[model samples]
Target: MPRFAANLSMMYTEHDFLDRFAAAAADGFQAVEYLFPYAYDATELRRRLDDHGLKQVLFNAPPGDWESGERGIAALPGREAEFRSGIDRALEYARALGCPRVHVMAGLVQPDAKPAEHRDTYLANLARAAEQAAAAGVDILVEPINGRDMPGYFLNRQADAHAVVQDVGASNLKVQLDLYHCQIVEGDLTATLRRDLPTGRVGHLQIAGVPDRHEPDRGELDVSHLFGVVDELGYDGWMGCEYRPRAGTSEGLGWLNDYQGENA
Candidate 1:
């Protein structure tokens, strides 16, 4: 069976952030993930996870100037210092949360930005972040956000993300393969899974409905079948339910029961 982690950032928005932990756990989710944890103290967040019996599976390292429209700094030249500092902060939280992985966002590319410079900076920063993450026993992940949701984002393709991981060549560096973005960018998810999961470089996985980003049960993608594919591939990582709830977070979870493992 495919173990799932509820994404608190998108789901459980009806409740306060801290309270969302319990909301997810009550709905039968064993683990949780989110976009960032910088706004809250790690201790407080860890307390919620412990209280709710939820494992913190994944979260992103700080993205640069989020309110100002800057998505990430990992690929931005001259922001290396800030990026490295964010890695430290994320790893600190990862340790506190007992999380095994962290996603490092590659920044957007501007018309004036040099791709070569950005690529060099990204690889160097990831290599450095991977080194830092290694000592903490936490893996660093890079995700490919599709152009529709994040225009001009540096990493937009699974192939590109995998290539970046290969270039970094860090045992701890891996791809956060989000199937929603994959379907938007390059469908045939089953084939992609067959090709990529065998690589053993995919650190984490995520999913949502195609075109709408809603509950997986109603999506164009057959998420239930994909769940079986993930099982067939022997993927041991948690598949994150990173989608906006069509209705109440709990009300829409009727789909979850179909995929729940016997022990879940």
Candidate 2:
């Protein structure tokens, strides 16, 4: 069976962030991921995970001022220093939590920004981040978010992410393929997985229902079938359940039970 990690940032929102760790454990999850972990002390978050017996599977590096809509600073010219500092901070937390991967957000592109300039900046920043991550034994992940959810996001296509990984020429740098975004940007999940998974460029995976970004059961995509594909492809990494529950987090978990039965 493919290991599924609850996205604590998007799941179990009824409880406080720190409290969600126990909630995920109670929901039968052995691992968890979130958007950012800098809000709380790494030691406190580590204690919560240990208490709940949950592994920290993944989280994104600091994305600058989220409140002001600065998704990331990596691709922004002249912000290389800030971007490297963010990588250091992320690795500090990753080391404390024993996490193995960190997603490097590419940030938004200004209307006047040249595509070539942005790509160069992004690749350079990633190259630097990859070196730092390698030293800490953590992998650097770059995800392609859908444009609808995040307009002007620099990285919006899977191929682009893969190209960035290739251009950086770092073994520790890999693409974080989110199925929800992939379905939105490009259909044919099965074929995409077949082509991309074997290349060894995909480092992490995420799933959500299409159109609504809800639990996998309610989406257009057949998540159970996709899970089977993932298993067939021998992907040993965690598949993150990065979706919003249409109801409560636990109430919408029937899909997981169903998947378990089918796989069994």
Candidate 3:
């Protein structure tokens, strides 16, 4: 069976950020992921992870001015400096936590900007981020978010994310394939994974129920079957549970229970 990581940012919202680590552990998760760790002291976060015996699997680099509505700055023109600074900050946390992968969000595209301009800025920023990440023995990931959830997100299509990874041409740069978003933008989950995983460009995987973004068990997508495909494809990376729980986080884990039984 594939290993799963709880997304503390989305799951375990019932508890404070620091408390979620223990909650996840108590609920049977061996690993965890979150949206951003910049708000908390890295040492404290690491201490909690150690206390809970949970590995930090993934998290995103800072999204610029989140309160002001900037999802990210990497793809926005003229914010290259800020983007690099965000990357450096992320590396600091990754180094402290021993997390291997960091996802860089591509900021929203402005109405006035051309697609080519945004793409160019994104590639340039990622190339630099990749170099920095490699030096720290870490990998950088770019995810294609569904525009419906994040309107104006620069990278929205699976093909587009793959193309950017190719254009960046860095060994440490890869795609963070979120199945929820992929299902919305591109329906052929099996085919897409089959094509992308073999190329070794996939860095990490995330899953949630489609249309509702809830726990994987109740959606249009057969998440368990998809896990089977991932196993068949020989993907050993962490798969993040990046979904909002319809009930409580632990209460909605029946899907994982079912999955574990099938695999066991």
Candidate 4:
């Protein structure tokens, strides 16, 4: 059975940020993930996880000036210094939380900038990150975000992300395959998983309803069938529920219950 982790950043919006930990545990999630953790003290975050008996699976390294619309700085030229600082901060939290993965978002490609430069910067930065993370027993992940949701975002396809992993040639570097983005950018997810999962380069998985990011069961995708495929493929990492609920967060968890109930 695929272990599911509630994305506290996207789901569990009904509660305050700190309060979401208990809510997720109360709702039967054994693990949790979120976007950023730099705002809180690592000690307090660890306390919450221990109190609720939840494991922290993943979190994003800081995306530069998120409120000002800088999605990430990993791919931006001349920002390598900032990116490294962010990774250092992220690993500090990861070590405190006992997390194994840290997601590095590729920043948007400037409209008139040279693509080759951004690509070079991204690969170099990731190589450095992987080396730094390896010492801490953590893996670095790169995800492809669809253009519609994030226009100008670099790295928008699975093949592209995989190529990056190859280019970097770091064992600790891998891809974060999000099914929602995959469905929107390239349909035929079963084929995608079949090809990618066996490579040992995909470190994490995420899902949401297609066309409108909601519960996995509510979208055009037969999430149940896809999940079964994941199991058969032998992916043992966490499946992040990265979606917006149609109604309340907990109210839209029937899909989770259906799968977990059967497995339990």
lDDT of 4: 0.95
Each prediction's RMSD over C-alphas, in Å, is: 1.4, 0.8, 0.9, 0.8
Q: Which parts of model 1 are misplaced by more than 4 Å? A: 261-264
RMSD of model 2 against the true structure = 0.8
Q: Model 3 Cα displacement at 255 (Å)?
A: 0.7
Comparing 2 with 3 on lDDT, the higher-scoring candidate is: 2
Give the alpha carbon lDDT tens digit for every residue of 22-93 in model 4.
999999999999999999999999999999999999999999999999999999988989999999999999
Overall lDDT per candidate, in order of appearance: 0.93, 0.93, 0.92, 0.95
- Model 4, C-alpha of 45: deviation from truth (Å): 0.5
TM-score, every prediction: 0.97, 0.98, 0.98, 0.98
- Model 3, 50-116: lDDT tens digits are 9999999888999999999989888888998888889999999999999999999988886777998
lDDT of 1 by residue, 1-264 (tens): 778999999999999999999999998888999999999999999999999898999999999999999999999999999998999999999999999999999989987788888999999999999999999999999999999999999999999999999998999999999999999998989999999999999999999988999998776999878988999999999899999999899998878875674326
- The better candidate by lDDT, 1 or 4, is 4
lDDT of 2: 0.93
Candidate number with greatest lDDT? 4
Q: Which of 2 and 4 is ahead in lDDT?
A: 4
Question: Global CA lDDT of candidate 3, please?
Answer: 0.92
Question: Which pairs of residues have clashing backbones in candidate 2?
Answer: none
